[model samples]
Target: MEPQLLHTVTGQVATVVIRHPAKRNAMTAAMWGSLPPLLETLAADPGVRVLVLTGEGGTFCAGADISTLRGSPLEAQRLAVAAEEALAAFPGPTLAAVRGHCVGGGAQLAAACDLRFAEEGARFGVTPAKLGIVYPSSATRRLVSLVGPATAKYLLFSGELIGTERALRTGLVDEVLPAGELNGRVAEFTGILASRSSLTQAAAKEFANGRTDRDAHWEERARESGDTSEGVAAFLERRTPRFS
Candidate 1:
């Protein structure tokens, strides 16, 4: 059978599983190609309020599948870039529920998400140094945004996997649950996000991301938009905003 990128929706949450467990959920090129469309579909679907990215067989992604690189190195490189862009631009909140080794591209995947809830036994790293490679721009920007430029430089320079405790201290993970308790913690977290208003969540995320990069035009646009008024009214009425 073709390698699977398992996907399923439950209520307002959808999970995209990295399924190649025997290889520690290493993703092949074809699987990478399929992910952009899958993410696009999820982003467009009003029903999906949140997304959880996990792995099969107790492990998160190990990185790009090296075996597939032998066929077309250049194509593989381009595809990987596009995949990261797709992930970075995903509209809804995304949570990475990580365990085992989250290394190399695995680190990139988790970094792209809105939040990361890690297992107590989790490990994470960006291993470009070990592979004699350089990290890409989009990935670097995302990492730098989360942990600051100095920390981002240190982690990339070291290419060393860090334990869950250190990962949390560095702000790489939002929470570090006991190894066996990660799944339950992530379920609880996603359930909370799913129950919230999707429109408010999207706008709040956008505002947060753009907080540092202020634009007068954008501010004016938001001011002119009447959604905030309706949101305030809904709050007073204890009702959800009928966002247009």
Candidate 2:
């Protein structure tokens, strides 16, 4: 069967699942091409507050399906890079829920997300070196931003997979939980994110990603939005703020 990128939504969270368990969810070129449009639709939906990227079976993405590379390498690279950029540019919070193998392009996609949570047995690596391919500069920069240059080099240079403990220690993963607890913990955290003020989250995300400069317009827009007033009122009244 061909590889697939599956989309499913529950409440405010949308999940993009990489599906191809026969190949450990390795993505095909077509799957890579599908991501940007899917994310754009979700981003435009007001009801969707967060996105979670994960794999279909016990494993997360193993990387790009090498078989596809034998066809058109240039096109495949373009699609893959486009997908990674789209994920990184998503307006709302994005989390990578990882398990088993997350190597090469899988690691790049996870690095693009705002946060990553992994099962205790998850393994991560950046493996272009193994194939004699240069890692994309944008991906390398994101990796460096996440784990710092030395750790990033270690993964890229060696193409050696690391366990969850090492990933967490290097700041590659935000949290690591036992396999049984991963989903529940991710749900708990994303629920909190969904309930928070979107205005605040958007501003913070832009700043943290270094995509914008500090300006008076940001504060002006926030005040005009009245999100702060509602938040304060909700706090005083002991009620959840109805943010739209």
Candidate 3:
């Protein structure tokens, strides 16, 4: 199949699958360029509450297609940074459903997500060192925030792949599962996320992403959205909340 970003919405979850099986799902420059616009479309949909990014088959992503960099490596890096920032700024929760090799630009994309879940045999690396390309500063800061300065340095400096156990221990991934159970768990968790209050989730995401000035904004939203009242009523009445 031609390399592309395939997206579909089922209920409140939108899944974006990276397809480039011949190169272990390595992202082409065009694929990187397509992500921001595609994510913009998904973010605009009122029905979409969560997004799951994963690879087409066994590999999540190996990295960028090296051949694409031959013409202009800087331009390729620009596209990649744009795509990573777009994914990071997605309004609702975003999860990276990772398996197999998540390296280089693939690791960059996964790091941009709000959460990550890896299968048992998955491997992860940030490989700019291997390519003699300097990692973008924004991406580096984000990685530091997630896994701390030391661990981030280890990955960035060494360009060595780490196993699932090390990844989880260092806070790079939120969860790990056996080979076949990842899809089931991802579906079940995203369903729960979709069922919760969008207002609350939006507010929390803003705060967690380092936007400290949004307290008043979120307060106004809670007062106007009716979600708080619905939550209280649901608790008192012994039923699930129907958050709007």
Best by the TM-score measure: 3
Model 3 / residue 107 / CA error / Å: 0.6
Report the C-alpha lDDT of model 3 over 93-175, residue by residue, as the tens digit. Answer: 99999999999999999999999999999999999998899999989999999999999999999999999999999999999
RMSD of each: 2.9, 1.1, 0.6
lDDT-best of 1 and 3: 3
Q: Encode model 1's per-residue lDDT on 45-147: one tens digit a residue.
A: 8888889999886789898888887888668767877887787678888999898989888888899888999888888888878767667888899899888
Cα-based TM-score, every candidate? 0.86, 0.97, 0.99
lDDT at 145, model 1: 87
Give candidate 3 regions above 4 Å deviation: none
- Model 2: per-residue Cα lDDT over 98-201, one tens digit each: 99999988998999999999999999999988888788889999999999999998998999999999999999999999969989998999999999999899
lDDT score at residue 225, model 1, on the 0-100 scale: 67
User: Among these predicted structures, which one has the highest lDDT?
Assistant: 3
lDDT of each: 0.83, 0.92, 0.96
* Superposed Cα RMSD, model 1: 2.9
lDDT of 1 at 229: 78
Off by over 4 Å in 2: none
Better of 1 and 2 by TM-score: 2
**Candidate structures ordered by TM-score, highest first:** 3, 2, 1
